[model samples]
Target: MTLALSVDGLSVWYGEERAVHSVALEVPVGKVLALIGETGSGKSSVALAAARLLPPRARMEGRVLVAGEEMSALSGAQLRRLRGEKVGFVTQDALAGLNPVMRVGRQIAEVFQFHRNLNRRESAARAVESIEQVRIPEPAAVARLYPHQLSGGMRQRIMIAIALALRPPVVIADEPTTALDVSTQADILRLVRELCAELGTGILWITHDMGVVAEVADLVAVMYAGRIVEHGHAASVFDRQQHPYTRALLRTLHDMRAGQPGDPLFQIEGQPPSLNTVITGCPFHPRCPMATSLCATEEPVSQRFGGLEGTESGLVACHHLGDQAGAMT
Candidate 1:
């Protein structure tokens, strides 16, 4: 299977503080790879860096290839063209991503005009079609409306329409369902999955919602601090989680399903550490229930597990796999 997006040893830093560390992953065409972690876990940093949209204050290292084009090797003009033609980004905040002053139609049409060189009349027609593609009713009327004039869900649908207008080979979505109501969130999720699959577009979905991951991901990468702690097929990661953090996260998801309205919710005990904090061993050792002296003193390297008896393989960074397995028993 060919990859639509590939990252090898990708790292990002802001001045002296590192936000992402030696991350590696791949998004195969027509598949969805969900990157999930709590806030400050460097999930967004990895996504933004992969998209080559990092701010100037941030510095990046390692290689990122999108649609088989290495980002680092592309000239400014070439990079811009690559982004416009082959990459689509659906941001978390639809309002922030759109031009407030411009009608949603014109904003979506601009992509066709600039990248595909469609004239105003042609691009305008295509914009309406794209809006309809997202299942937004009354596309022409909605297209003429300003961002502020539309409801949150409508604005979000417009964002998706704009991103997919060019049928980019790769789509990077940053928490696309953050603030929508439950029903609308489900609608948006279904729409995005259907549209991407139809277009044969691979996705890098950056989100904290485990429910969202379970819903759409073909593969999953769980991040902690700045490193990926667990990664594999979504089924393996969720059904046979290897890392302590991954297990804890799924426990939270279980709590959501098993709890009542008046019941107290389960949550992880400690907040994530700041990027400025110094670390000597596993970044998660301070909060890991399975942590031991070894976990505190020696950083754990990633070790492959599973692939036995027809099981899918996975990578995990944990010193006490044997102990964790025993605990699970």
Candidate 2:
């Protein structure tokens, strides 16, 4: 499959604070790569960096390639053009993303105005179409409503409508269903997956939900602190987890044993270290149960597991994979 987005040694800093560290990954055309991690794990930071939407205080390094172009090197104008035309983002908070004062239709129409060069009438028609495409009932009526008028799920669908309005080659959805109810979350995930598949759009889905990851992700990248700790086929990573952090995350999801009392929910002990602090070893070592002297002093390089290359699939960063089962205490 052709690579839609490639990130190499990508790092980001907020003034003097480092938020992302040497993160690398690839998203192939028509694939869903779920960037999974808890809060402050740098998942959303990676997405924002890819879209060139980071705040002015952020200083970036390394490469972010979108459809073969070096995104990190693009001029401001070029980045804006690329962002709406080639890559679209549905942010975690739908309410914050939309303009509360503008009618939803006008907001959707703006996509056509900016990217498609459509006149007022044409853009209005297209906006209605976009609204319908997202399965909003009575598109015309809904179009006239402002952001504050819609339910959380409806607002999120509107966000999706705007995102897919341009048919961009890549889409980044950060915590796409965070505030919705469970039923609504399921519907939103289904809509996102179906739409992306139909459009053959590469999707970078950033979320902390393991259930959502299992449902929609083709591949998974587990982030810890500011780095990718494990990445692989979703099934492989969830079913045959290699990294201790990854294993700990999955173990928290359900009872590992069917009949017996399942292990207690394993919580990583400490808070994520401050970004301003200089990390000398595995950032997760402080919270990890299996931490050894080596873990405290040395950061493990990402290596292929399940017999594959780093770029191909099945990658992990940890010192004791061979001893994982026994390491969990």
Candidate 3:
């Protein structure tokens, strides 16, 4: 399969603290791979590392390739060109990601002018086209307004338009719909899934929402405390979760569905380990209900597992994967 983005043993550290550890991920063309975990699980760090957008204080190891081009090998100008041409990024917050002073149309038009080297009029026209591509109505009129003038959903659509303006091979969306209302979130999700498929763009979608994964992801990677504990096809991962953390997360989803009003929200016990904390054995052992003494003293390597014949196989890292009582419904 042709991959739009590949990360091999990618690790990120901020001084003495490590945010990501030997994480590997792949985003194949025309598919969505949701990198999922709770806050501080290093999902965002992996995204930043993949895009070479990590902060100056962060040190990175391993390799990242976008559209078959190695990021570390590219020069400064080449790296900039690579970002503009090969990869697109949609940040979590639209208002923060966008320029408050610039008109939305001009912001998108600059992408065309800088990367595609289109003339002023050409770029302006293309900006409207990009906006319309995201399903925004009256694109030309909306394009002329500043980011602040638009509604939350429209601002998010603007961010998506900017990200996809160049039709880059790979797109990274970091929780782009977290702030939107239920109906607006559904619209945004559908818009992104349709646009990426039409353009044959591979998307690395970072989110904590399993519901979102069920809606849009073709594949899923479960991250916990800076490491990937599970990786597999979305259907396989959801239907037959093999790791304790994965089961816990899915249980929350089940509870949300089966619960009554004012019921206490289901949550995984214990907070995720801090980046500065030294972790021996499995990073999730402290919080994992299925963890044993072996889990506390020794790390579990990934193993292949499948639910039924002809199903897509997946990787899970858990010492007690065999114990399957009360499997997530």
| lDDT tens digits, residue span 73-158, model 2 | 78778778777778889898998899999999999998899888999889999999999988889999999999999999999899
Q: Stretches of candidate 3 above 4 Å error?
A: 176-178, 254-266, 306-311, 322-329
Candidate 2 stretches greater than 4 Å from native? 176-178, 255-267, 307-313, 324-329
- Which model is ahead, 2 or 3, in terms of lDDT? 3
Decoy 2 TM-score against native: 0.91
Judge candidate 2 against the unseen true structure and give its global Cα lDDT, from 0 to 1: 0.83
Please report, as a residue range, the 10-residue window in candidate 2 with the lowest summed lDDT.
256-265
TM-score of 3: 0.92
Assess each prediction's global lDDT (C-alpha) against the native. 0.84, 0.83, 0.83
- Tens-digit lDDT track of model 1 for 222-249: 9999999988889889888889898888
Better of 1 and 2 by TM-score: 1
TM per candidate comes to 0.92, 0.91, 0.92
lDDT of 1 at 296: 94
